[model samples]
Structure formats: C-alpha cells, structure tokens
Target: MPRVIGIDIPDKKRLEIALTYIYGIGRSVSNDIIARLKLNPGMRAHELTQDDIAKINTLLQNEYVVEGDLRRQVQNNIKRLVSIHAYRGSRHRAGLPVRGQRTRTNSRTRKGKRRTIANKKK
Candidate 1:
C-alpha cells in the first residue's frame, strides 16, 4: 500500500484506479491528475517515486478540497440549509431522501426498518 495524503491506496491497482480510493477523487479526476502530472496511469501505485508523490500532494493541497476538508464543507452546507429551514434541509434532518426520491416504498435506506403499529382492542 502507498500512502497519499494520509490515506493508504492499494499498491496492486493501477495508479489511475488507485488514486480514486481517496475521497473526492473519481475516475475522471484521477485521470486528469495523472495527465497533468505527466504520470504513467498504467503504473501501479507502489511504483510511484517520492518526487511523484510530492507533486501529487502539492497539487491536491493547492488545487482541490478533499478528504476531511471536503466532508466538513458538505456538513457545513447542510447545516446552513437547516438553519434557513430549506425544504431539502428538512428532509436531511428527518433522515429522508433529499433529492425528491419517493418515500412511499423505495426509501427504506433512509427511513430504516419498519415500525409496526399495534391494533387497539376496544
């Protein structure tokens, strides 16, 4: 495993794919990073030289919000929305889907396990 920005990336995977293990970096962004740094995307993560690692770290720190910072930024945005009492924010606060997803049947992921209501005997 190779450590990048404090995250351990799988050494057996190609550099391009391995880079995506880091938060906020997907395939496209990983490819772009490889291209900008002139790195061999086909090379395994373990093959990265110290200079390459340094360049990657510098580029990520200067040009991108990632990892802990990205997570914190997202949380802050949600908090702001909640403070303003936005509709979407209310959904988030309620632990429901926020993207207009139907909750009638398909939102078990957000709604959790079903709670049964017992019948009352007269």
Candidate 2:
C-alpha cells in the first residue's frame, strides 16, 4: 500500500485508480490530478517516488477539500439544510428518499421491512 495524504491506496492498482481511494477523489478527479501534475496515470501506486508522493500531497492539501475536511463539509451542508427546514432536509430527517422517489410501494430499501396490519373480521 502507498500512503497518499494519510490514506493508504492499493499498491497493485494504477496510480489513477488508486488515487480514487482517497476521499473526495473519483475517477474524473484522479485523471484531472494526474493531468495537472503531469504524472503518469499508468504507473502503479507502489512505484511512486518520494518526491511524487510529496507533490500529490501538497497539491491536494493546497487545492482540494478532501478526507476529513470533505466529510465534515458534507455533514455541515446536511445540518444546514435540516436547520433551515428544507424539503430535502425533512426527507432526510424522516429517513426517506431525498430525491423525490415514489415511496408508496417501491421504497422498501429506505422504509425498511413491511409491517403487517391485522384486519378485524366482522
């Protein structure tokens, strides 16, 4: 494993793919970082030199919100929405789909297991 910004990226993967292991970095961001830093995307993470790792660390720290910082920022956004009583926030608070998915029948994943209601016989 190679450590990048305190996160251990898999050593066997290509540098571009391995970079995605870091929080807030995805395939596109990884490609963009490699392109911007002029690093070889095909190189394995384990093959990175000390200087290359240093450059990546520096670049991420200076230009990106990642890892704990990114997590905190997202949490803060959710909290802000909830505090403001937004519709999305209410959905989140109710543990339901936040993106307007119909919950009448197909939202079992979000609404959890069905509870049977017993009917009284006349």
Candidate 3:
C-alpha cells in the first residue's frame, strides 16, 4: 500500500485508479491531477519516488478540499438546509428519499422495515 494524504491506496493499481481511493477524488479528478503533475498515469502507486509522493501531497493539500474537510463541508450544508426548514431537509429528517422518489411502495430501503396494519372484520 502507498499512503497518499493519510489514505493507504492499493499499490497494485495504476496511479490514476489508486488516487481515487482518497475521498473526494474520482476518476476525472485523478486524471486531472496526474496530467497537471506530469505523472505517468500508467505507473503503479508503489513505484512513486519520495519526491513524487511529496509533490502529490502538497498539491492535494493546497488545491483540494478532501477527506475530513469535504465531509464536514457536506454535513454543514445539510445542517444549513435543516435550519431553514427546506423540503429536502424535512425528507432527510424523516429518513426518506430526498430526490422526489415515491414512497408509496418502492422506498423500503430508505423507509426501513414494513409495519403491518390489521383490519377489523365486520
């Protein structure tokens, strides 16, 4: 494993793919970083030299909001929505889907286990 910004990326993978192991960095962003840093995307993560790792670490710290910072920022955004009583916030608070998915039947994954209602016979 090769450590990048405190995340241990799989050494067997290509550098571009391995970079995506870090939170907030996806395929496109990893490719962009590799391109900008003039790194070989085909190179394995374990093959990187100390200086190369240092450069990557510096670049990520300076130019990106990642890991804990990104997580906190997302949480803050949700909190803001909740404070303002937004519709989406209410759905989040209720543990329902926030993307207008109908809850009549298909939302069990989000709404949790079913509660049966018994009917009285006449």
Best by lDDT: 1
Model 1 lDDT per residue over 2-43, tens place: 788999999999999999999999999999999999999999
For model 2, what is the error of residue 74's alpha carbon versus the real structure, in angstroms, after optimal superposition?
0.7
Q: Least lDDT summed over 10 consecutive residues: which range in candidate 2?
A: 113-122
How high is each candidate's TM-score?
0.93, 0.88, 0.88
Q: Model 1 Cα displacement at 34 (Å)?
A: 0.1
Q: Is candidate 1 or candidate 3 better by TM-score?
A: 1
In candidate 3, which residue ranges exceed 4 Å CA deviation?
113-122
Model 1 bad stretches (over 4 Å)? 118-122
What is every candidate's alpha-carbon RMSD to the true fold? 3.1, 3.8, 3.9
Local distance difference test, each candidate: 0.93, 0.92, 0.92
TM-score of 3: 0.88
Residue 87, model 1, lDDT: 98
Predicted candidate 2 versus true structure: per-residue lDDT over 17-99, tens digit per residue? 99999999999999999999899999999999999999999999999999999999999999998999999999988889999
- Superposed on all Cα atoms, model 3 deviates from the true structure by an RMSD in Å of 3.9
